[model samples]
Target: MKNHQNPRRTFLKNAALSGALATLTSGVSLASSPSKRAVRRDFNLNYAPHFGMFKNHAGDDFVDQINFMAEQGFPALEDNGLMKRSLDDQKRIGAALEKNGMTMGVFVIDPGFNWKVALTTGKEEYKEAFVKECEKAVEVAKIVNAKWMTVVPGYFERNLPLDQQTAHIIDAYRMGAEVFEPHGLTMVMEPLSDNPHLYLRHSNQAYMICKAVDSPAVKILYDIYHMQRNEGNLIANMELCWEEIAYIQIGDNPGRKEPGTGEINYQNVFKWIDEKGFKGISGMEHGNASPGKEGEQALINAYHKADSFK
Candidate 1:
């Protein structure tokens, strides 16, 4: 299932590692070295790193972090908290990403997502509030050149029946879609696994809602870490709802850190998705395996190892 997506990138990586005087171990380490400056070796897939993921290497400034990601050859960037940043900061991030030729991944559309009385309650006030959020997200998306925003159905209204709650979710999302469709934007529904009390907890349920909503602007965010926690059969479940997925997020379970720090074999998952022809970004929505600059290098090395799937 290996994908030769970029031959020049392959050539660059191979050349950088093929120096005749190099030892086997140094060649491997040099690919993602911890030096202040490392040679750019583009990842096979568009794996994105978020802010603070590489702060020790890039300093605390956000734009500087973007520069460091570009230097390390990240193909995209995702910031869940982008909507809350000031207008100047957003424009600077947008310009930095554009300068680096990186794609903007999903941002949480409604940062104030209520966990108490979610959309499942069939409350007009809640739906109306979400529509306003959608309007606001549209403006935010424009600032970052983002096409997708993350959405979630809040907690289940335990008093109501299941079917009624499901209907309410579809109706509300349909309204959100109406606002985004004209602007060529999509709302990617995220199914989280923080706790059992949350309503949108499964891929099939999110898939059903997206299908029911029946809009191009409505789709699934598909966070692998949460999906693995909520349902263990990752590949099978992904296949069942592949078409409805618009964006993908990456995080290994148990530690919610880099790939090899947990049980999930991300190499296999990356290979499968590449084989499936997914050209979108995979948000690195996890923390470094360790602390500080050394940990940052470990994160880079882990992705290099996982992306080496064949």
Candidate 2:
């Protein structure tokens, strides 16, 4: 039977067996070798992830976290409480960021805000204090090579007239702008939506303040999460204040988690911003939906999907 078999059939059977053997060998080789490290993909936007967002995957060490973020191609970082971190830690983080070629995002300049007299009351001491904080922010910015710092005008003063309060806030920002203007640093105003007591809660409000300040050093942070809560028309509001918008922060509404875990259509928003040629960083200022490494990976995947928009 073998002698009578056709040459074509024999060749075909041999070829099939050889191909299977080669595939099996390749599988074995791959399985035996150490798994290749994942290559970082270039994201469409400079999405700034805060420290500790990837702690589960990268550990609690700041340098490790920064390295992990770089490995995953996160081009920038924003830490609202960066000034509160120890000077040594700040230096270490700055070094890590520099080594990884990452951009430093916004850090909170005034942690002691939220007082009635801070910026709205027009108190001389309060204004001086805000300006002093701006000075300190300049020093911190020098350390981290940061260009933007977040400034919250603080709570509303019930005793003061609304117009007077607005004027005071504007004056305070103008004074604050003086400190960083020489250093080529910007203080991006953040409008909070947590409570009615807090002042500067809308994009238009921030836009007006930025206009009043009339300096490149004073611009709006344009936090999407808070804006979505305070005013539902995100894209329109974004466009209204597009010119003065220096930086952007991102968090989905209902739950301040990653994009896909909430109601915000981040794909459209990202696409719109990209189409507009926005060269600023969008800080991922939200929490993860789940816990541990799996959740961190999910958050990364969510951004990849959102940024896939053409």
lDDT, candidate 2, equals 0.81
Instruction: Output the number of the lDDT-best candidate.
Output: 1
Among all windows of 10 consecutive residues in model 2, the one with the lowest summed lDDT is: 23-32
Pairs of residues clashing in candidate 2: none
Q: After superposition, how far is residue 293 of candidate 2 from its true place, in Å?
A: 0.9
Against the true structure, what is every candidate's RMSD? Answer: 10.5, 19.6
Off by over 4 Å in 1: 1-41, 111-113
Clash counts per candidate, in order, are: 0, 0
Candidate 2, residue 107: how far the Cα is off, in Å? 0.3
What is candidate 1's lDDT per residue for 1-310, written digit by digit as tens?
A: 4344456435533442242112111212333323323334467777889999999999999889998998888867899899899999999998777666566878886736565896898888889889998999999888877877888888888899999999999999999988986666778999999988888999999999987876768889899999999998999999999988878899999989999999999999999999997777789999888999999999999999999976
Q: How close to the true structure is residue 181 of candidate 2, measured as C-alpha lDDT?
A: 67
